[model samples]
Target: MVRKLLPPLASGFLFGMGLTISGMTDPGRVRGFLDIFGDWDPTLAFVMGGAVVVMAIAWRVQARMVKPVFGERFSLPDRTDLDPRLLAGAAVFGVGWGVAGLCPGPAVASLALSPVYAAPFVAAMLVGMLLQKLTMERKVSNP
Candidate 1:
């Protein structure tokens, strides 16, 4: 259990550090990025670009590896084609991000800095996840 938890906890810490360093832990900073016509900030784009670059490199490394440290092998998503569900989810996520200015990772990190807004943001996120699970369960049962 300790072995399983360590890597994820370490990764979360690093992710949180990145958010803090990039000023993404601040809702105001995120809101500024969302505001295109008024006091817009482009920092989030750079952060995202950097993340993409890192993910590209990491994916390459993972592909070459025979197995992961804990798991037998990585089970990546098989779907390469975009569908309506994917597009709809992206749109909903974008809208939520724009309105809340706090995605899951950063919102959890913001808690360390005592951001009161993070509580409700995190609560809503959890509720959304639960709803998605319930809907998926219903679909599976119906099908």
Candidate 2:
């Protein structure tokens, strides 16, 4: 159990810490990044770039490995086709991120600092996720 859970826990802890340290937990900072037309912040770009570089290396490592060290198999997305659903979801996510300045990672981390603000965002996110799951399940069953 510990072997299965520890890597994910560690990764999530590191992710949360990175988000907090990068000022992503601050709505003002995130909003500033989104405000490219106005007083835009460039720090998030650097943060994003760093993440991309790290993930690129991780991907390369994964390609070399037969399976994850902790898992029997690596569960990864297999879909390569771009569809309307993907575009629509991206647009919705972008709008939500811009308006709220709170994506899931930062919002969850903010629960430690400001439950009053994070609680509603987290609740809404959960509801949205549940709705998506139901929609997907219905489509799969009907198809």
TM-score of each: 0.87, 0.90
Estimate the lDDT of model 2: 0.92
Report the alpha-carbon TM-score of model 1 versus the true structure: 0.87
Clashing pairs in model 1, backbone N/Cα/C closer than 3 A = none
Worst 10 residues of 1 by lDDT: 77-86
Cα lDDT for residue 44, model 1? 92
**Candidate 2, position 75, lDDT:** 85
Worst 10 residues of 2 by lDDT: 77-86
Model 1 bad stretches (over 4 Å): none
Tens-digit lDDT track of model 1 for 14-118: 999999999998878899988899999999999999999999999999989999977887888766757887888889888888898888899999888856879
Query: What Cα-based lDDT does every candidate model obtain?
Result: 0.89, 0.92
lDDT measured at residue 46 in model 2 versus the true structure, 0 to 100:
91
